[model samples]
Structures are given as C-alpha cells and as structure tokens.
Target: MSDAEAARALAEGHLVILPTETVYGLAADAGNAVAVAAIFEAKGRPRFNPLIAHVADAVQAEAIAVFDARARALAEAFWPGPLTIVAPVRDRDRVCDLARAGLDSVAVRVPGHARARAVIAAFGGPVVAPSANRSGRPSPTTFADAVEETGAFAAAALDGGDCAVGVESTVVSVLDGRVSLLRPGSVTREEIEAVVGPLDRDGEGHRSPGRMALHYAPDAPVRIDVVEPRPDEILLGFGPGVGALRWSLSPSGDLREAAANLFRRLREADREQPAGIAVSPIPAQGLGEAINDRLRRAAGFVG
Candidate 1:
C-alpha cells in the first residue's frame, strides 16, 4: 500500500502492518483506545504487556513521554535507531490508558526506518505498534513473512523491505533518575552505559514488550547450544563443521549477519515440521547478545 493510504488507515483507527528498523509492526493510533484494543485482540496479546509508541522523532516522543536527562541523552544519541525508552507519561490524556496498560509510564521509540517515519509523520501522531505477528510468534523481518503471519488482521500492509537491525530495539526504562535495561536488543548494555554511565540492568516491574519468557518462539520446540542435532531434529547452523543443516544463520560466524537471519531462519526451520530445532551456539556479545536473547526465549527459558 502507499504511504498516504497507510496514514489514512491509521487515522481511521485501523491497524497497518509497517516495517521498522527491527521488525514489521502492527501499528494503530496511540491515542485511540479502540484501535489499541484491536491490536491486542488481533495478536492475542496480554494486556499487562504494554505496547511501544512509535513516533517520527524525539520531539514527537517527548510530547507523550516525560524525558529526563538520561532519557534525553539516549534519545539524542539513538533516535531514529533501535532504542526504546520507557519514561513517565507527560500527558496521560494524550496517550490512551489501554496503550500504557494503565501504567503511569509508557514505552516509546523513534524508529529509524524512513518509511515508518514517513508513515508516522503523515499520520500526524504517535502510533502504538508491536511486532506484526501473533502473540509469542517470532517477529517478522520480511514483508512476505509479515503478510504470511500477520497480514490477515491488518487493514493494510506497507512493504518497506527487510529490516536492517533484525532484532527489536534495545529497551531502557529511565524512571526516577534511574536507568534500567528492560530488554536486550541490537543496542547492547555496554553501548548504553557508555552514554548514560552505569545502568541498573534491572528487568523487573516494567511492562516493556518482548519481556515475556516464552516470546518469539516458533511452533516447533527449540534447542540452543547444540553440537549435534537429534535424529528427528533440524539443525540451524552458525559456523562450519555442523554436518547437514536445515538452515544457516551465518556461514562465516558473523553475528550481525546471524542476528539479521535469526528469525527468518527459525521460521524456515520450523516449516520442516521437525520434532525439534538444534541451534549452533552464538556468542553473547554485540548483536549476538540480542540474537541469543531471542533464542533463549524461543527455547522457553523463564526469567
């Protein structure tokens, strides 16, 4: 669909599947409670897990969220990129209570995708968008995946091509003069600490999306750090020396490439209908940290 058409759909309180730097999102008007409720119903998402409000830029983000020094610093450094900041709501009335899940704080971000920014700018307001797939499914990185997995529920789908970052944005909660890492993504804790100086690294008491233990999972069971695949399992290989494999996240052990291919590879692996998926080990550094986070969640790790 065209950008104008997507904006019109969002203005009319309809959901649109749009691409972000991280993943395709199921977006709706953040101020419209009815539209936000439709997002929950369409995704089968639990209300307690709040949605992130995406905007065109830091100015639009600050309009809804009360950003303090640290939040502002991070936003200045990472706006138009993969970083989500959780802060107190500046105007509770402006952001529908349903979007924040009745919490005083809201998770907000300025996506780096040009098409997403254009859609938000054209729509003329903040949009409450979560990953454009059913609850607990792997986030869609390609337009075709978004259509195959989530297009049924959206009013329109905007094809912005494959996501660059692949993983979701790094989510940090800056409340009460304290900064805490809620969910690890493309932005690493080390990167955030460099700008904000020492982070709390806490993940509790916040309603940030993608924090659910079993999220981003595929239909088949997943096995992580596996050296050899079971007879009935399909292996998702990372580096060489892994015999036959259903798919390879990266052939040269490049984490950035691996991160980009993670979900799409899992989706392809699951399509084989294997009893389980054995995944080669990924280093927990750089984008690999984010990739492993999703893999661990996909493997059903709680907490």
Candidate 2:
C-alpha cells in the first residue's frame, strides 16, 4: 500500500500493517485511544502489555516522551534503528493512556526503514506499532505473514518487503536517571553499554513489551541449544556441520545474519509440522544475546 493511503487509514482510527527494519508492525495513531484499542483487539493482545510508539525522528520522539541525558544519548545514537526507549511520558494527555497501558511511561522508537519513516512522516504524528501478529505468536517478518495475521482487521497493509532485522527492537527503559535493559533485540547490549556506560539489567517496575514468557512461539514446540537433533525433530542449524534437510540460520557463523534469520527459520521449521524444533547452540555475545532471548521465549522459558 502507498504511504498516503496508510496514513489516511491511520488518521481515521484504523490499524495499518507496515514494515520496519526489525519486523512488520500493527500500527495506529498513538494519540487516538480508539485506534490503539483496535490494535489490541486485532492482535488479541492483552491490555497489560504496552505497545511501542514509532516516531519520525528524535525530535518527534522527545515531544511525547521525557528523555533524560541517557535517553537523549541513546536516541541520538540509535534513532532510526532497531532500538526502543521506554521513558517517562512528557504529556500524558498527548499520548493515549491505552497505548501506555495507563502508565506514566511510553515505549517509543524511530524505525530505520525508509517506508516506515515515510508512512510516519506522512501520517504526521506518533504511531504505536507492535509486532503485527496475535499475542504470543511468532512476529511477522514478511508481508505475506503479516497478511495472514492482521489482514482481516487492519484497514491497510503497506508492503515494504522482508524485514532486515527479522526480530523486535532492543528495549531499554530510561527512568529515574537509570538505563535498564528490558528486552533484547537486533541491537546488542554491548552496543548500548558502549554509549551509556553500564546497564542496570533490571526490568522491574517497567511495562516494556515482549517481557512475557511463551512469546514469539509457533504452532510446534521448540528446543534450544541442541547439539544433536532427534530423529523426530526438525533441525535448525547454525555455523556448519549441519546435516541435510535442515534450515541453517547462518552457515558462516555470523551472529548478525543469524539474528536476522532467527524468526523466519523458526517459522519455516514450524511449517514442516515437526514434533519439535532442535536449535543448535548460539553463542551468547553481541547479537547472539538477542537471538538467544527470542529462542528462550519461543521455547517457553520463564524468568
């Protein structure tokens, strides 16, 4: 769909499925309570889990959210990329309470995708767009998958091709002069720490999204850190030495590539109707941390 059409649909208080660098999102005007409500109802998402508002740039993001020094530094470094900053709301009345889950903070980001920026710029306001899928389902990395999940409910679907990151944005909360990592995503913890010294690593008292266990799952069960695949299981391999009839996340052992392919690979494995999916071990460093975070959630890990 065109940007004008998508913006128009959003202005009218309707859901719009649009692409981002990370994943396709179910978008609506963040200031419109009814529009935000449509997003929750369409995705079957629980009201407690808040949504991330996508803005055109850092200036626009600061208008709704109160960004401290750390928040400003992070936004200056990672705006227009796969990084979300949950900060205290500057004006509660400007942002619909539903979008913030009735909290004083709002999860906001400036997406890196050109199409996403175009739509936001055209729409001329903040738009809250969570991953465009039913709650707990694997996030849609492609337009076709988005159509299957939200096509019926969304007023328009803006196809901007496959998502490059193929995962959610790294979520960090900057509240009370502290930076805490909430959910890992395409951006690494190391990258964030480089900009803002050490991270608090605590998510308590924050309403950041993607904190739930059993999220990003498919129809079949998933087993992670598997070195050997059982006969009945579908093998999702990484690096090398993978046998035939397996989907390799990154044969070159590149964590960035592996992170980009993680969700799509899992979705492909689930499509095979396997008894379970056996995922090869992915080292926990850099982007691998985000990859493992998604894997653990897909495997139904809690805590």
TM-score of each: 0.97, 0.97
| Model 2 lDDT on a 0 to 1 scale | 0.88
lDDT of 1 by residue, 1-303 (tens): 799999999999899999998999999999999999999998999898888999998999899999998899999988889999999999775578999989989899999999999999999889988999899999999999998877888999999999998888888999988899888888888999999999885555456888788989999999999987899988888887664544888887888888888889888888888899889888887778788889999999953
The C-alpha lDDT values of all candidates are 0.89, 0.88
Candidate 2: where is the Cα deviation over 4 Å?
none
lDDT of 2 at 43: 85
Q: What is the C-alpha lDDT profile of model 2 across 116-235, one tens digit per residue?
A: 999999999899999999888989999998999888998899899989998899999998878989888877888899999999965653478887888899888989999988899988
Q: Candidate 2, after superposition: displacement of residue 110 in Å?
A: 0.3
Error of 1 at 28 (Å): 0.3
lDDT of 1: 0.89
